[model samples]
Target chain A: MKYEILEHTADLKIKAYGKSLEELFMNAARGLMSVMYEEESSKEGKEVSDVVLETSGPDKEALLVNWLSDILLESDTRNVYCFDFSIHTINEQKISSTMKCIKSVAKEDVKAITYHGLTIKKHNGKLEATILVDV
Target chain B: MFSKEILQKVQKNIWEIPKSYREDMCVPARVFASERMLDDITTDRSLEQLVNVSTLPGIQEFAISMPDIHEGYGFPIGGVAALSVEDGVISPGGVGYDINCGVRLLKSKKTVKDIESSIVDLANQVQRDTPSGVGRGGELVLSQDEMDELLEGGVPWIIKKGYGLEGDEEFLEQGGRFDEADSSLITDHAKKRGRDQVGTLGAGNHFVEVQKVHEVLDDEIAQTFGLFKDQIVVMIHTGSRGLGHQVCTDYLRVMVQAMAKYDITLPDRELASVPFLSKEGQEYFKAMNAAANFGFCNRQVLTHLVRGSWKQIIDKKEDLSILYDVGHNMAKRETHDGKEVVVHRKGATRAFGPGHPEIPKQYQSVGQPVIIPGSMGTFSYVLAGTNESMKQSFGSTCHGAGRRMSRKKAKKVIDYNKLKQELDEYHVVARAGSARGLVEEAPGAYKDIDDVVNVVQETGIAKKVVKLKPLVVVKG
Candidate 1:
């Protein structure tokens, strides 16, 4: 599993796992998308649009927050559901990705990606991070 | 890792964790809650978050938490910190993502009997008039220039546009507008998200509730606020919607980078900070004020919509005047103990005491009316700020019942159909956007509001004025 929902009292928290840094970023995006649209059931006649997202920060943790924040803002402002995150390039400070998005209204709103207790770590040959999202 | 044993009882309902508890803490961490409430409080990381707040530069006296304090990202919800403007730092995390997420009380002359027959229709009418639910936009759309003007002008702009009744702005904090707001400082992305969200009640604990004055605890103060027993009133609980959220997200990134330059280190990155006088800090302060203005204007537009709903179902001539509008998430300049400080109230309401210059003139004599909204299908309260609060808690009090359970736990334990049936049994006409949303906000997820309020009253921070029970609840 790329991500699993963690119990939080107020906001939403998720732990995403990846085999590599690029995979970690992709999985984090997927985790965010899963929360916004819980049921990934149908895709009939949905408008498909190709879009690229790029964000850079001082470090990996900040980069992950900015990346998810970019996706959240794009979803809210454009009213589109982002899915299938395809990371073309990623580093400790920057990430670039192209995703196939569907023209569907979001089922919910994830307000912001927070850096509270955020740390990217390697464990048992897998990269993982616990992200707190303000909903 | 916090436990009840480490805390020392300061008074009847106040407890303190001295600065000795943590080597990094600059001051003590104080909490206002009864002994019984400590069991629930220690179960979360809220106290540790409070300790983190104590370590912030230039924080005054002690870091304070109200009875409703709950674990949030950086600062705990229901946390209050007073920082010296000259040396203190402004953290976006301190004000929370939903800037000015607040509550406003609208007083009507009619009693419950007058609107009893139309309760269901009234709830449906309000649900139709106000745009709510997740990711929903309102009918009123603003152009880019108009959006900037709205960000600068706030509630007065709404009044000038004929969206609000005359004298509506007077009852709001800061007269419903912060003059320090600079619309140019607000980012384009924030503007884009907020342009059409002026009259929306965003989901996740936001609502427009029709309540009745079930009990008048203090008749004199209740009368001063134009509330009476059995009187029907409307409470609007919302904030700046997506615009405010984006602003916080934008600044948190900026501050995180700026922190390295300032040589400031914190226990949590979410509590990033820079000196209040720094260039980046000033820019963020201006941008935050702009978002705060947007929050006040959002509620004002919703008030206009709710008024329209009221006229359609009840008497067309019925007048619904704002009793008070209080923002729980904000940072404001205020004087306590003759020293000016920037008070950050994240999930905490500013309850300026009686005769405080910031309060409305009429309410100044009795103190500001602190509107505390309980969880859905629970009893809310109207309390008056007291002088003691200024000395005790920087003129602040609890915001709500505060979450005691996770959303996941609530949904798992609560049956939506049964919850709806319970609301029906209580004569509450509930209009929810989603069944899952309704279950997540189940009253069982929150602490017992009555106990929270009793702690506030016992601490003498705020005096109870009246108790309000919902007649109709429109959940976002």
Candidate 2:
């Protein structure tokens, strides 16, 4: 279980788990940065930015909603809060990654990254997905 | 997963579900609600997302929702459909990621007994001149030719860059510009996330309350819009922040790859679609009317910063006018029953009755005000629009008090200090950026804005004329 938080009523559902497909797109960017910094827990000593991204969608659920909407638009236009995702090349359309961001500060406002009940599943031999953010 | 025993009662407080309960419906789906709010709207996949919005394509006479229906994310939050601009389809998840998330009311000449001792310093100076949480950013930035003259001169180009006032663009709505907005069809990352989020207020359940006029159910339509009773008003709620959530995440990823070059098969890839005269649906309907003219210039620059916090805390010539500015996540291009469709209204509310020739001739004999807003210590409304809501709801209604619990069950049974001691036992004067976004906007997590405006004034779709309550709320 690389991710879990599901229970939406007005957006912010998660499910992520994987065994490849670049670890379900890096646990769906660690379940959209753990439900967007769920009440901000310390991410200590700031200034750590490594970025590098790329997107393409045609499949794999629009390449996982253009890879978590380009890590939520590089964490809301570079205000910064992304997490540890490092998928180096994915398929079913496109992806390339490298992450680790921080200048954090987001106690809610993950407003877009929804394909409602998106899918990316498999059973027994594990793999999962269930995203939806729009908070 | 469809049940409410396939609803039927299609009249008094309406309800239907037909279209053979599936097999890719193309019609039947209504739902005004009340039969005890249809057991809290069939306990929620919003009637299977209004039966997948009656299977899209050219939807017309049905596919409605408005009893403040819930379960949003691809049209369910108080939905409404209407399609057919010759041939339908235009889903930016049917206008959800805050494209024109709206509400605006204002109207102050002092009351609540002349501002009961300046209600908590006018809600802490209107939450310090309107800069709210989550990616805040305000103090009016712009530039990029003033965000393309505010994405094509909306709010009369922010009232000629002096923010606003002079007849606040005739009580808003379309007066706040929508000349098929086209700031070069948006993007420069939606103008760098809406260059400094014009007059910000960007969190969930956005707000900026401070009301009063508690009750007057139509004294000649609340004196034709200048409302009365204990007077003092001001509502706000927000929209188009982060440039209408990145122009709906850049056209729902260019309509999910132009829905395979317009073959448009959808059972929810978040309702992605094309053809409203494709070219990627007329460039996402002119970039969603330039993100709805940056949501009417981000609530007319937060009504010019809540009229400079009611003239810096209740005096220096406090006027605060503009009595209407609705938008409830739009789509517009109406005409109804005389054809030319395209309505949409996600989280509905248009309500254009009483001599509707686009209202405002001093409210053309009393209509088009319809504000709604409740939850955050309940009671809020203003209602008007009718001709029986343009023959039963194409002139839509209902926009708030909708969420029936679940910001994770309202933060697992609210208790942010007992919901701030029940909003200080209703003397209110809250203010937050997050006390868990104020216990996930708890007013018992909504639905009961007087039973959703008494099912839109007992089904005429809208009429109630006043009742407001809160005395300063402000959130983000």
- Show where candidate 1 strays beyond 4 Å: none
Instruction: Name the Cα RMSD for model 2.
Output: 20.9
Give the distance in Å from residue A23's predicted Cα in candidate 1 to where it truly belongs: 0.6
Task: Score residue A131 of candidate 1 by CA lDDT.
Answer: 96
What total of clashing residue pairs does each candidate reach?
0, 0
lDDT measured at residue B200 in model 1 versus the true structure, 0 to 100: 96
How close is every model to the real structure, measured as TM-score?
Answer: 0.99, 0.36
Interface RMSD of each: 0.9, 8.3
Error of 2 at B437 (Å): 16
- What DockQ, on C-alphas, does every prediction get? 0.85, 0.29
Q: How far does residue A41 in candidate 2 sit from its true spot (Å)?
A: 12
